[model samples]
Structure formats: C-alpha cells, structure tokens
Target: MKLLALDTSSEGCSAALWLDGQITERFELAPRGHTRLLMPMVRELLAERGLKPSDLDALAFARGPGSFTGVRIATGVIQGFAWGLDLPVVPVSSLAAVALSAMEQHQLADGSGVAVAFDARMSEVYWATFACRDGLPAMQGNERVCHPENVSLPDPDTTTDGWFGAGQGWKFVDGMPEAIATRIRSIDTSLVPRASQVARLAIPAFHAGQAVPAEQAQPVYVRDEVTWKKLPGRE
Candidate 1:
C-alpha cells in the first residue's frame, strides 16, 4: 500500500510516505509554522520517493485533541489532498498516534499500557489510554478533555508493564490523581504525535475498510463546544 500521512496536531509538523512496507518522513518542531512547513514536507516526501500525489493509494493523518489550530491545519491539508487525488482518508486520533509512537520508541511489550495526554490549554488535558497490541495502540476507552486530576488511567491488572505516560500533558503529573501517578512507571514529556505512527496505525484501518471519502472524514475534537464573545462595539 502506498499511503501518505501528515500530522500537525501539536508543536510538530510532519509528513510521511508509506510505500509497500517502508516509511519515510519529514518532521520539525514548528509551533506556528505548520501552514508553511506541512505542504513542503509532503511534497518533499513524495518527491524523494520519485512519486506524486496521484501515486498514492490513500492518505492518513493525526486528527485531533491537540492545539486547536494545529488539528485544523492537518485536517484541512489531508482533506484537500484526498479530494484532489480521489483517495481514501483515515483519521487517526492524535493521542493514539502519540501512544503508538511511544510504544515503538520504548519497545514496550504487547499488553503494555500507554496513557497519552496533550496539555490542552485552559488547565485541562486531552487524554486517553491504550494497550499495545501487535505493535499498535488499541484505545482502552474514549479519549477525553478534562482537568489533569480527572484523566483516566489504564486498569493496572490488564497491562503487562503497569503504565507508561507520554506527551506534554505529563508535565502535569503532579496534578493527576495519585492512583494514576503511582501506576506510571515512566513518562516522556517530549513526545508528540508523528505522521509515521499515524500511517502505521492507518494501514490496518485502511485495509479494514475504515478509510472514508474526503467529505466524510471529520476531525475529532473531544471537547467540541467552544464559546466566544463579540469584541466590544464590533457587533
């Protein structure tokens, strides 16, 4: 399968091309540079592989629960690519991508529990737990946005390695429930979702008929409702 993936769901901007079984990627920690960096990364990845947008069989992306602007950027880019190329798209969770990335980087065993959290602004976190299965992260529960103290943890008895934490939200470890804090064997504060992992997670889903039309693919924002106030005298 020749799939292209991109992620701009955090401070990082990345793009990947998964050809057959090998993957190549371009990534950078660019806080507000995604709009500029993302397309070039995609173009370069395809160019390096001696391919073009038409050569891709499908597209995938890290879809949400990170910087709101970042999530929108990735979603827009992937949707545009899918529409123009007439390819299917798979939206992988931003948290799931981080969890899978951590699992691979740490070489966690099957059944190892991974709890991923993104420091969602406004004193809350975007969080979820996953269990490593066959080198992939299978979410254990619904992803949510909540105060650090209310984030969920994996069931201790079910995982082989207690629990490991990943993402900037782990920076709030002191605020998390003690029950969760005590179970985490380690945490990676530097970790962010990447396109390579997004592609890896998407491969199985793509084959399983999870890929959708560009118009059908939508971003998943755990905390969906947003409130805004009109600017003074600017009705």
Candidate 2:
C-alpha cells in the first residue's frame, strides 16, 4: 500500500511516503513553523519516490488532542492534498500514534498494552491506553483529556496482562506510583506523533476499507467543545 502522511500536531512537523513495503520519512522540530515546513517535506518525499500525489493510494494524518493550531494545520493540509488529488484519506489519533511509536522503539510484540501520555500544556495531559494486535494499537478506552494529577494508572485488577507508559507527559509529572512506573517495560520520551507513523497506520485502515472522503474529513480536537461559538441564535 502506497501512502503519504503528515503530522503537525505538536512542535514536530513530519512527513512520509510509504511505497510498497519501504518507508521514507522526514521530520523536524519546528514548533511554530509547520505551515511552512510541512509542504516541502511532502514534496521531497513524493519526488524521492518518483511518484505524484495521484499515484498515492491514500493520504494519512495526525488527528489530535494536542495543539489546536497544529491539528488544524495537519488536517487542512491533508484535506487540500488528498481532495485535490481525489484520493482517500485516513486520520490517525495523535495519542495512538504515540503508542505505536513506543511499540516500535521497544520491539514489543502484538500483545503489549501501551499507556501513552503527551504533555498537553496547562498542567494537563492528553492521555490514552492502547494494546498492540499485529503491531497496531487497539485502544482500551476512549482517548482522554485530563489533568496530570487526575490521571491514574490503569487498574491491574481488570485490564490487560502487561502495560507500558510513554510520551512526554509521562516525564512531566513526578513520583509516578511504583505500580504504574514499574509496569512500564520501556519509556521513550523522544517519540512524538509524526506523519510517517500515521502513514504506517493507514496500511491497515486502507485494506479494512476505512478511508473517508475529503468532504467528510474532520479533526479530533479532544480539548475543545467550545470551538463552535454561541451562534447568533436563541441562547
């Protein structure tokens, strides 16, 4: 499956082209320059693979609970590119992408349940729990938007057999209970959601027939429910 993916959902801006079974990725830390840096990465990846946008099987991106501007930038770019080329698009969750990244770093198998958290700023974090089945994250619960202090380790009393914790948020907080921190087989803080990872995720979504049309494209802004302002309507 040939796919192109982009992620600007944090300080990182990354792009990738997945051709046949090989992957080519480019990433940089441009905290506020994604809008400018992203397209070039896209162009380079496409050119490197000797392919055009139309030759791509699908477009993928980081749909998020991270930066509001970053998520918009990613989805907007993804939509513009995918729609213009009339290709299918798949949106991967920023948190889930982190979990996937963690798995890749540790060489974990298909059954490792990963607990991932990204520093959401404002003393809060964007967190989620996921398990790998065939090297992909099958989230245990809905992604969460919560404060760090309010977040707790999953109950070993009920969830999966083993768990791992990763992402920046894991490092931000202090004194993680031993039960939680110790359970972690590995911690990869350098890992962040990247477009390349999202493209890798699209592989399954593509064969599963999960790609959505451009007009139906949406952002997963877990932090906001008030973006739709009180309209000029009965209030």
Candidate 3:
C-alpha cells in the first residue's frame, strides 16, 4: 500500500511518502515556516517517487497535541488534499508518533513502554503512554494535557517493566516522582513527532479500514477547553 503523510505539529515540519514497502521523507525543524514549507516538502517527496495525490492509497497526518496552529495547519492541509483526491485520511496521534520515534531510534525492545510528552506551552504538557507491539507503539491510555506535576502513570503493576521517556516535555519539568523516574530507562529530550513516524504508525490503521472522509478528519487537541485569567497590569 502507498501512503503520504505530513506533520507540522511541533517545531518540526515533515512529509513522508510510503511506496510499496519503502519510505521517503523530508524533515525540517522550522518553527515559523510550516505554512510555507509543508506543501513544498510534500511535493518534493511525491515528485521523487513519481506519484501524485490521486496515486496514493491514503493520506495521513500528525493530528494534534502540540501547537494549536501547527495542528490546524496539518489538519487543513490533509483535509484539502484528501477532499481533492477523494482519498481516505488517517489522523495519527502526535504523542504516539513520538513514542514510535523513541522506539526506533533507541532500539527499545518489544514490550517496552514509552512515556511520550510534548511541551504544550503555558507550563503544561501533552502526554501519553504506549507499549511496543509488533515493533509499533500502541497507546496505553488517553492522551492528555496537564501540568507536569499532575502527570502520573496508569498503574505501577501494569508498567513495572518501565517506560522510556521521550519528548521535550520531560526537559521542561523539574523532575518526575522518584518511583516514576526510577522506572524510566532513559529520556530523549530532543525527539519530536515527525511525519515519517506518523506514516509508519498510520499504515496499520489504514489497512484496518480506519480511514475517514476529509470532513470527518479532525485534530486531537487534548486540551479541549482553555481558561485565561487577566493579569493585574494586562488586559
């Protein structure tokens, strides 16, 4: 199966094309130019593979739990492309993608769990946990947004094998509880969700008949509601 995927959900912007069983990707850590760079990156990958939007089996994207604008950008772009090509869309979780990256990059063995987190600004984080299954990270719990201090694991018994901490959120927080920290084998503060990883994760979902129409494709912003309090000197 062939698939095209893109992600602009963090400081990085990336596009990946999965043809046959091989993958081609373009990635850039551009914090401000996702809007300008995403399409070109997508086009470049397609061109390299001599494929078009209509030639792909499906389109996938990192759907959310990162920058609001970044998530919206990817959602809108994928929606438009899918609508135009009449193709199914797969929305992969950004946190899950991070976990997949950790698995591949760190060579975490099967059954290893990963605690994925992304700095969500405002002193909060977007976090989730996933266990490696068939070399893929399967989410263990709901993705969520909260202060680092409020973060906790599902259950010690369930995660006793421990999880590898991945993403920038772990860097922002002072530290996790001793129990949790001790369980973590290691932490990768430099990792961010990329399109290549999203596509890899989406392949199974795509084959499982999980794709949706363009209009039904939605971003998963864990923080559904935001409340703001005006500071004394600010509006």
TM-score of each: 0.94, 0.89, 0.92
Q: Candidate 1: TM-score?
A: 0.94
Expressed as tens digits, the lDDT of each residue in 1-235 for candidate 1 is 8999999989999999999999999999999999999988988998898997898999999988788788888877777788778899999999999998898899988979999989988999999999988888889979998999998675567787678999999999999999888888999999998999999999999999899988766677787695222222323
Error of 2 at 93 (Å): 0.8
Tell me the lDDT of candidate 3. 0.86
Candidate 2, residues 1-101, lDDT tens digits: the string is 78888899889999988888788999999899998999889899988878878788788888887888888888778778766788888888888888888
For model 3, residues 48-85, the per-residue Cα lDDT tens digits are: 97877778889999988888888888988888888778
Q: Candidate 1 — which pairs collide?
A: none
Candidate with the greatest lDDT versus the true structure: 1
Error of 2 at 190 (Å): 1.9
What is the descending lDDT order? 1, 3, 2
